[model samples]
Target: MNNKSLKRWTFLDTINAALLIVVVLFMLDFQNNATVSWILLAVFAFWIVTVILRNIFITRVMKDPNHPMHPQPGEKNNAKD
Candidate 1:
């Protein structure tokens, strides 16, 4: 039930990281402009919260027995070929 693999970088992780950089850059660029600076900061905070919530969701799914990662009581994996 370990989710070590989920901790690895995914496409979402890459995009999030990229967006984070963009947001930070925008925030810096708008330092003198309070409106734009606040907007960029809010976007960055939203991104951070979303990443945290996504990880929480993935963890929940991984722990669910009915999830694809775990086979049902009488179901056999068809991977033997």
Candidate 2:
């Protein structure tokens, strides 16, 4: 990826982090002693954990190859045919 793409990805990462924090906080504030509240909280927890792990693993792969996030048009054309 070029500098521009890298910057865009960084922005996306920031948004994800913010949303995760909001979800966690929502889980805490939810005032219901029902099964549904518990289930929702668990789902949010799973999503947050998965996002963290995926970012860690994918980041390594992304750096190994140039244009990890995006390829030039000609480069992708070669793979198609």
Candidate 3:
């Protein structure tokens, strides 16, 4: 993939990691609280949705000829032509 695509992926990964950390911390801190458990569940659900959406986006972009990450004729794989 191109640098731009790599950077985008890195950013998305960082956000996901941050969310996971938050969820873990919250679980540790409020393991006995019912309301906090529900809130954490919502956050976890949102994280899962984001991961699924990111995968879908990557698949679509890789398949699109016009996308910068897609390889073109006479160009190296993952190189923009």
Evaluate all candidate structures by whole-model CA lDDT and list the values in order.
0.63, 0.54, 0.63
Tell me the TM-score of each prediction against the true structure: 0.55, 0.40, 0.52
Tell me the lDDT of candidate 2: 0.54
For all predictions, the C-alpha RMSD in Å is 7.5, 8.4, 5.4
Q: lDDT tens string, model 1, 1-81?
A: 432334424677688789878767654665478787778778778877877786676667556878765445555533221
Clashing pairs in 1: none
Kindly report which residue stretches of model 2 are placed more than 4 angstroms away from their true locations once superposed: 1-32, 65-81
User: Could you tell me the TM-score of candidate 2?
Assistant: 0.40
Tens digits of per-residue lDDT for model 3, 1-81 = 443432234556677788778777756445478787778778778877876686677677767979776655655443121
Q: Please, what are the lDDT tens digits per residue for candidate 2 over residues 1-81? A: 442222223545677677768766764444565565677677767866766676665555455665455444444422211
- Model 3 pairs in collision: none
Q: lDDT order of candidates, best first?
A: 3, 1, 2
Q: Which is the winner by TM-score between candidate 1 and candidate 3?
A: 1
- Number of backbone-clashing residue pairs for each candidate, in the order shown: 0, 1, 0
Per TM-score, the best of the predicted structures is 1
